[model samples]
Target: MSDRDPSVSDEEWAAFVEAARKDGVGSGSVPEPRRRGFRRRPVRHEPEGWRTGPAWREMNGRGRARRQVKGVVGITLAAGLLLLALRPDLITDRLPEGFGGPGETAPLAAETARPTAPPSSEVFPDHPTLKEPFKGSPALGWANGAAGIEVPRAKAVGGMSSEEVAHALDSVKRFLVAANLDKATLRGERPTGAIKLLDPLQKDVRAYIHRSLDEPDENNDPLGLFSRFDPAEVRLAGDVVKARGRMTFEAGERSGEVQVHVDYTFVYPLVKTRPGFDEVARTVVRRQMAFALYDPAKIMTTRGLLYVLRMDESAGNSDCARDGDGFLHPQFSEDLINAAPLPGGPEIDPYDRSKDLADLPKACGTVTRT
Candidate 1:
């Protein structure tokens, strides 16, 4: 059985031959089909059979090449698409530095960021300076005064600045001291600044703190931070902050329309000098956390008051370390090994006033900075 149409007549053959002669044999012309080295391979013929013709031979070669070409094109296109899917950054990063500058760039997917706080020296210069917690109204109500008992400062969705968020986190610097040294906070007495940071979520969250401090677990007291003695002997410095770039807060599981998300990492040292001991005990606490709060009235400056709907705790280490130059070095906690959803990272921020980070982790265990 022949695969050719098999019904071709003498008339069709005559027309094909006429067209080939007219278009071929070089009357100063190259047929489109012959451009790619496509030509008929001569074949033995059987009388009156369609398979024994030049036209058939030419048609077979042309069709085979066309199919192979189509397959190659399809395969190449598919491979290119796969590569692109795996690495969209290859295309995105090549865009101009200002590709989406100023108020035009799209925000990142989540607020998953570490803090970018300025160094400790810059934020709070004098250490061990005691501050009394607000004696009356603030711990109870708006204490913000003219702003009224209702703070209307909650920012719009994604409106809080890194500075603002860092400020909120920094506001707790003294709190750490107070919590560790001052009895006021432990008993639920929050300072004016600390009150603001704890706003919207104030009471319940304060209770949470009290409970944590009261926990009887030894591990919970890590190096006596929660159970230690001596407020007069404690001294510390920190550079807590949020990650640079587009840091944004969105509505959390509890409804963002009525709340704002707050997340950051805090890095600081816990320095304590004992009355009888000559050497001071030193430890660094690197705490990373994600929290959501409710303050739709914008009470906490528009982002609403922080009401800690969700929280995560990272590592903190008391291991004393010395730099290459022999100066003591601080670090995030070792608790990450136990259970820190987000592992701790070194402290970093643009506002560092230190001449150098001692080249930092490199500076650790290395020669002291010259």
Candidate 2:
């Protein structure tokens, strides 16, 4: 009456039934099979909220790994910030205008006598391009072209009428524009416009200008009166030249004459003549000159023409050891890398217009700023 295999022994069948009964087989529940060399441990009922199971343990391990990774990243970021705070100058010089670097401010009027802060030690600290030729310079805020050369209100001076004084001031401004801002004159060409404004009777001054342009030397430097550059070596970074200064008039030392004084600083941004170069170097030229305006009625002189009395100039960022080539050779970053120390007097701040030209040393000197 048994459904057991007929080939099975009676004792073996009895033992199998006992094992299956112990495992809960045929008791209206499924049973786990027993392996030959393994014994099953008794199962205990665990609480519902217990998370000691295999899946929960794996998830906890992954969470711990994520927390460790986050800790490492946070430590790295803190260290970098600490380094930056400790050594700000490491990156401050390289930062472009605005992200905590030096910012450009509006230019003060040429007549304003306010004092300016000392310039940075680096002459060319910022990387420059044609679009931002005046980068890292105070001249960035200056007026372009002839706008900076402002004339004071004309008034009677040295027995001259207001109309005559106004005419004299206008003529002086015109001569300045032609000599320094004219594109043709800047390209190492003769400044005919400036020369024609001179009085024909001032033979000595006229001859000096002609000689300087024709045969420039240490003594007869044309840069004393004009701002010229060699086209083969460098070119203007942009069409605009930054200029700032003032003009005034006073009674002359002699009778029937007025002395028109012109004091101006010109900034010229230059780049290499070759293609594919973006580096910029600036030359600062400050000219202080006196011109005599004679009244035609009292003195036998041309009414419109100006008489050059005295001229003094100072140039910054130029090659102190250059030959008499009649052109401004600005010292670029590359040129200063391996160049010998310039033999000159103490460092002079070219941008400081507060100091008189006579106060400047009479020898070649280094500059504090470009």
Candidate 3:
């Protein structure tokens, strides 16, 4: 039933609602309404006293009360939304307790962004060894310890299929927009939650998409507050070798490590945040999430980017502190810090042997080595 009928489709109307791929964004050219075969309806003039006159007051006081009630209702709705946008805790703090197995606590925001839960002593899963593309393997033609380079630049090898990169970027863009955008962006004051697909067949399908303004993520977390997401590196060779993005927001942040574990169904490189937030510091988390893509029309109805199978986490920040310039830096690896990651982003601890892993609440067995 394609409701392309002229009468219904061409009806002149406006919607004050939200619509888009993620939320709080939408884009697409709506073809101009055709005037043919449609007669213009005359505007109804207001009755006497509607504006300056007092005909309503002379006739009945109930009508005046009704108008006042409507005004209050509209103001109440708008105020609620604004309050939600600014505070956001009405979303992020209500997550279902437990992440690993039964009887686990939340992994964030207790004791001032420092995790307080004890590590689970369950048997650990065997994480697949990380591949060293720059050295170690004969394929790249280099030795691991022979190079005394301060920064080990992992060469981008050929592994990600064209489809994988496309969809992965698709997922990343969706995640970034949702994480950083807000309802204030609805009027175009800021960027909206949306992604532009490159498929030629869908050129006219529209780039902007927004809905679920009040919807929360699977963990019940709100869309993040960062104003932007600038992807610095994206890679996926033989199991998502590396995919890193950076953003600087005012808060206690995190540092992430890399992984290429093969046991999972879909293995994309990930930087995840640790389970805390204390001081205002730049943070990064390796993103290793589990996901599935489908036709936009079908997938849009469900949780969409608000839902994901799994993700990675940074080692905790027990060892992080402010440097001399008042900028956050790793207490152990200050010399190895980078600008994009700030001081709290991922890549601080490679193996996550510190209490950071133990601090993860609602522990996921402490062995979901993404």
> Per-residue lDDT of 1-370 in model 2, one digit per residue for the tens?
1222234455754564456446553344322211111001111222221111111211322111100000000000000011122224433433333223444344545664424543333222344468987765667767897999998888887888888888889989999999999999999989999999988755545676788799886555677678899989999998989898788888765455777888788988899897887777777787887777777666656767887665667677667557356787776656755766544346566777877666555555455556
TM-score for all models, in order of appearance:
0.29, 0.69, 0.21
Best by lDDT: 2
The residue ranges of model 3 lying beyond 4 angstroms of the native Cα positions read 1-168, 171-191, 194-219, 223-281, 295-307, 311-370
Candidate 1 stretches greater than 4 Å from native: 1-155, 158-204, 213-234, 237-247, 253-272, 275-281, 293-304, 319-370
Local lDDT at 204 for model 3: 17
CA lDDT of each prediction against the hidden true structure: 0.25, 0.62, 0.21
Across 12-37, the per-residue lDDT of candidate 3 in tens digits comes to 31121211212432123221111101
What is the model-wide C-alpha lDDT for candidate 1? Answer: 0.25
Q: Candidate 1 vs candidate 3: which has greater TM-score?
A: 1
**Which is better, 2 or 3, measured by lDDT?**
2
**Model 2: residues >4 Å from true position, as ranges?**
1-105, 112-125
Per-residue lDDT tens digits for candidate 1, residues 146-231, read: 11111123344434444444444333333334333343332223333443455432343455344434542222222112213223
What is the Å distance of residue 77 in model 3 from its true position? 43
